[model samples]
Target: MAIQLVTDQLSNVLDDTLRSQLVGNFKEIEKALNDLDGAQARLNSDQDKINQDLKNIKDGNEIRDVNVQAIVNILTKYDVPIQIVNGKVVDTTKEGE
Candidate 1:
């Protein structure tokens, strides 16, 4: 039954080959997953920084609005002609007119 022995040997070899390929594929998948995790971490860090920057910008705009209102109030109290030209307050009052 040498043919039977040879058939068994062929089956064993095929099984070994399949196991090796599967192991290699699993290793590649693990590496890809690790790379994706690192990329996700970087993206999260970038998003946090962007969010902080946006918050700072919003805070700065609110402070600027408060200061602009204060300036308008002062100008109005002093009876100065306040003219807004191109988003800027221009004092149109002249001394000794």
Candidate 2:
């Protein structure tokens, strides 16, 4: 769903005329957002893996809080605030705002 939106926006974000007269840091912003999404996806996948590992664990080794903190750090570095409600990633950013 989000991937389609990114594709659609990429098509319109730069036209020849506008690209020549750029006034803001949109390119950098877009790159940062893309990086953020990639990191978020990796974090989510790792989290799922952690959950599966937990279910299969039979020993006393516990999950470390720092592991989750590392993921949060990556997201924060890109100015992406992850909205997790009831164990799901929700988009809180306003559209075209």
Candidate 3:
């Protein structure tokens, strides 16, 4: 009878130890998951900002092209020869001619 009581106590202690270890491991896993989620959020935010910046750059380029075309038209109207070379406008009218 005494041995049976001792075995029961040992079994209960082992069960408690296993439960505690499992709880600790779960807590660690939860923390790691939370950290990963935070990192992903930050990455998403950065990507959005980069996309917006690219759009802004495209819009600015379009505006610049419209302005350049207007200038070219005005120059043509005045009989001032101009050429666009490598995205730059160059006046081709000779000063002496």
The best candidate by lDDT is: 3
lDDT at 68 for candidate 1?
Answer: 87
**Clash tally for model 3:** 0
Deviation from native of the Cα of residue 69 in model 2, angstroms: 39
lDDT of 3 by residue, 1-97 (tens): 1111122233355587667666666777777779889999999999999999999999999999989989998888988799677889998877998
What RMSD does each model have against the real structure? 10.7, 25.9, 10.7
The per-residue C-alpha lDDT of model 2 at residue 97 equals 60
**Candidate 2, 48: how far from true, in Å?**
0.4
Q: How many backbone clashes does every candidate have?
A: 0, 0, 0
| Cand. 1 TM to true fold | 0.70
**Per-residue lDDT of candidate 2, residues 1-97 (tens digit):** 2322223234354676455334234665677789999999999999999988877673323344345556666786798876555644555678886
The most accurate candidate by TM-score is 3
lDDT by residue for model 1 over 42-84, one digit each (tens)?
9999999999999999999989977987888788888878855
> Which segments of candidate 1 are over 4 A away from where they belong?
1-14, 83-97
Q: Judged by TM-score relative to the true structure, which candidate is superior, 1 or 3? A: 3
For every model shown, what is its TM-score relative to the native structure? 0.70, 0.37, 0.76
Model 3 alpha-carbon miss at residue 85, Å: 2.0
Distance from true location, Cα of 25 in model 1, Å: 0.5
Q: All candidates' lDDT scores?
A: 0.75, 0.62, 0.78
